[model samples]
Target: MSWEESYHGRLRAMAGDEEVLIMVGARCLLRDDQGRLLLIRRSDNGLWACPAGGLELGDSIRECAVREAWEETGLTPTELAPIAILSGADTVGTNQWGHTYQFHITVFLATAWTGELVTETDETTDAGWFHPDQLPSPRTANVEKSLALLAEYDRTGVFVAP
Candidate 1:
């Protein structure tokens, strides 16, 4: 099992099933050389989102972004640019075993990447490149924020509070 699963299991055993945990995660707004954004359809909810995952112990935030991008979408991030830091009350819905979480996410713009497009079927059902204006419906909050941050960065070369 993943560290997150093991940690959550231990936490649930100690604190009960309804406890809220604060998680720190990393998300990557990966883009191809053609400037198309890469989005993955989550296996759990089937909503499109940028590649992301919770950080494991001893992992740096950038390392987590690189690892999550490759794990979920098979894209090796070559360059990661800090886009924004998003923190708030975002519900991470219950797991199959009914464990819920809240997360503070660090978002990055993967400006350069390599490797063929492939989806990790266990975590993602679909992965594809889409134009910014042609994104799929029902985007995850992180994805929406990433896009907005990218737009703002492009416009002013700065990412301000939204």
Candidate 2:
């Protein structure tokens, strides 16, 4: 959906950028056979992040993740399994556009996907796969949190809630 048409975007427009809104979003994590993580360079902030977006009017959280991944990178996730619900008090931030949001993001692990990768889109300046050990600079802070959530799931063998 266009920013003007999205629920969060309309909320931001009505409430204004300075007003902090509670937002629900989702992020999808994809890995190559080599275990390299997929990352996108966001056009808005130039921050490298997983393909993610806020929930639109009719999408389930999982649908949002898949939609976002497709929108930003042209990859369609065939199967996405939720790994965590990241909604901590610290999960709040003001974007480069000065819109503050407290995010309730569902992070997903994509076990299967299809489509050719596109490096550039309206939402992203560049997209590529990277090793966790050698991530691109000026990446999103959420990258670390997403990884941590996954690690927590790994350690506990349960879905993370934080």
The ten-residue window of minimal lDDT in model 2 covers 145-154
Residue 41's lDDT in candidate 2: 96
Residue pairs clashing, model 1: none
lDDT to native, each model:
0.80, 0.88
TM-score of candidate 1 on Cα atoms, chains taken together: 0.83
Model 1 C-alpha lDDT per residue in residues 15-124, reported as the tens digit of each score: 77788776788889887778899999998898999898877778899998998899898888998887777776654555667767776778888888788889666789
After superposition, the stretches of candidate 2 with alpha carbons farther than 4 Å from their true spots are none
- Writing each residue's lDDT as its tens digit, candidate 2 over 65-156 gives 99999999999999878999978678888887788888899999996899999999989999998988899989988888887877787688
